[model samples]
Target: MNTSATLLDTLRAEVDQSLRKFLDLRRPLLADPDLAPLLQAADEFLAGGKRLRPAFCYWGWRAAGGGPDPAIVTAAASLELLQASALIHDDVMDKSDLRRGMPAAHKRFEALHERSGWHGSARRFGEGAAILLGNLLLLWSGEMWRTSGLAEEALDAAMPLHDHMRTELMCGQYLDLLEQAEGESTFEGALRVALYKSGRYSVEQPLRLGLTLAARGELPWMERLCVEYGRSVGIAFQLRDDVLGVFGDPAETGKPAGDDLREGKRTMLIARALGSATPRQAEDVRALLGDPALDEAGVARLRAIIEETGALAACEEMIKRYLDDALASLEQAPITPESRQALTGLAIAATARRT
Candidate 1:
């Protein structure tokens, strides 16, 4: 089999195993009748994630010369739990109703409240239940890590990375919220947010954590390479998501088309459109950029305006540039040929993902 296929199979197996373990760990807590609402939400929220984060973590371990062991697989699974927790909270914050083609955790709770004719506001019930579910996942994720049986030194070294990932992700999320509220996000600001929230946790930290777990010594050069590669892939992932948010088929993407426009996400494409738009065009674009009231026609018009303004082209060019940078970084890394090839294939696949 080809290298990519092998890597893909390995990752799938590992993630499947990790998910079963995750379900088992939560089984006891979920058995109580009082916890039914939260438990159901948790099960639903975690059921259909693509397992991208855990796959990345697993590949990172393999790329760092680490053999696949139960501990490593468990660590990767822990990352998936963390990802699920983050998404649960994120959907609540974004006021998103659909995730992975179903009602988000908050929305599910709200529906249940309404169906049962509960007294309180359904919105509050939804948000509250989702928050509790998120907290449960966070705690469970930590327990997974603790039970991994890795050395104390390994876990200790990974602590700062873990802390950094959470801090940066939260900071990035806040930065995004502030920018959207202010209606003025520079390219630099958006890039910073993408790197912190997506790039670091999605790529750099996973790679470093895996390496640390394997007791790999200080790899300053390799670290830099990973950051560059991560930043590139992260940006590409977000850019693709932005495109899908606006143009992808709802059936395929599992969300409403043009959801980003409705949410007024200040993406790189949006920033570029503003930069390229004429004075009158700028006003037109700004009017619809953050307006939650925009209908389907309004969204289509906005998308056309962005395309006409040459912003879409600029965004595509930027993605290509980052992919190039990622390739260069991988070429510069001093890992074995096999590891380098695996990383390269992942970079290609990540940049080219249609979904």
Candidate 2:
């Protein structure tokens, strides 16, 4: 019997090899040599993330009575491609300088433009190229899913879920952009964004899709329970991210301290803190929350206010509550014991992570 860590370690290895093999096949086919940088960007960016989506997808299959099938692993890895596309596009929209401790795709391309002595506006060229690269990755994700070598019956069973996952992902991105532009959010409004963006496509849909692919036929009741389980874990995951964004160690998170505060993320942590802060504290937050030039002193001040007002503790409580609910449902999920252990481990790690 595989240990829980062993199971995930093996799956992660399989997913990595699959990503490299898929990228290698495409590397030789790009007609223009200059376009090579985009491939490198995708490869490196793909290499750095935690592989959470693929893990969820693979476990979903296991929970549905599926055995150890490498084909399902290959299919699950495709979600990473979709994830890459979303992240690259987000970097562009946010004008972020770094991703996963490296230059953002747009900035990378801009540097390449400068090194090549390419003409025209470097900024425009870089951003335009990055956008197209994101589009290319998006297309390749669909290709990967379509050609994953699963049975046609299984593919058909999972295709609608895949379609919805993609739709929700894009819609979530748009909603995030709109939310940021709107300069504020209500608690309910922020939850709506989390539902579609981080919660649905990232966890719930992928889990359900994997289950559907291996199912003998429709199992609506099982699917509904899985959704409930996935949604709860997924939301907790996002909320934990918000807490880490404010209070995590910079080394563990691979970003500068208070990077979210610097970026003015307007996360639930910030919203809740403001909602509960004393009048003086609220005034301090409003003056500094979105200031790009906010320094260590300013970030520390805001963090203090957040903790003093109980927002940080409140978010932690919510994560624990949601995690408990998810685990409770997972215990009664009709899945095998091994699958239950794996799912429970994933939920805990995803929520308890520092990064």
Model 2 root mean square deviation, Cα atoms: 1.6
TM-score of 1: 0.94
In model 1, how large is the Cα lDDT of residue 30?
Answer: 68
Q: After superposing candidate 2, which stretches have Cα over 4 Å from the reference?
A: none
Count of residue pairs whose backbone atoms collide, per candidate: 0, 0
On the 0 to 100 scale, the lDDT of residue 87 in model 2 is 85
Local accuracy of candidate 1 as per-residue lDDT tens digits, 213-293:
665454556568667876677777677667777877888778888878888888877888888888887888788876767
Following a full C-alpha superposition, what root-mean-square deviation does model 1 have from the true structure? 1.8
Error of 1 at 205 (Å): 1.8
Model 1 clash pairs are: none
C-alpha RMSD of each candidate structure in angstroms: 1.8, 1.6
Best by TM-score: 2
lDDT of 2 by residue, 1-355 (tens): 8787787888899999998888888887885877678777788888988788999988988888889887888899999999999988988887777777788889888998898898998888889888988999999998888888889999987887788889888898888777777878467767777777898777787788888888945675666656679999989988887788789887777566787777777777877887898999989988887677889999999999999999898888888998999988887778889988888878888888674
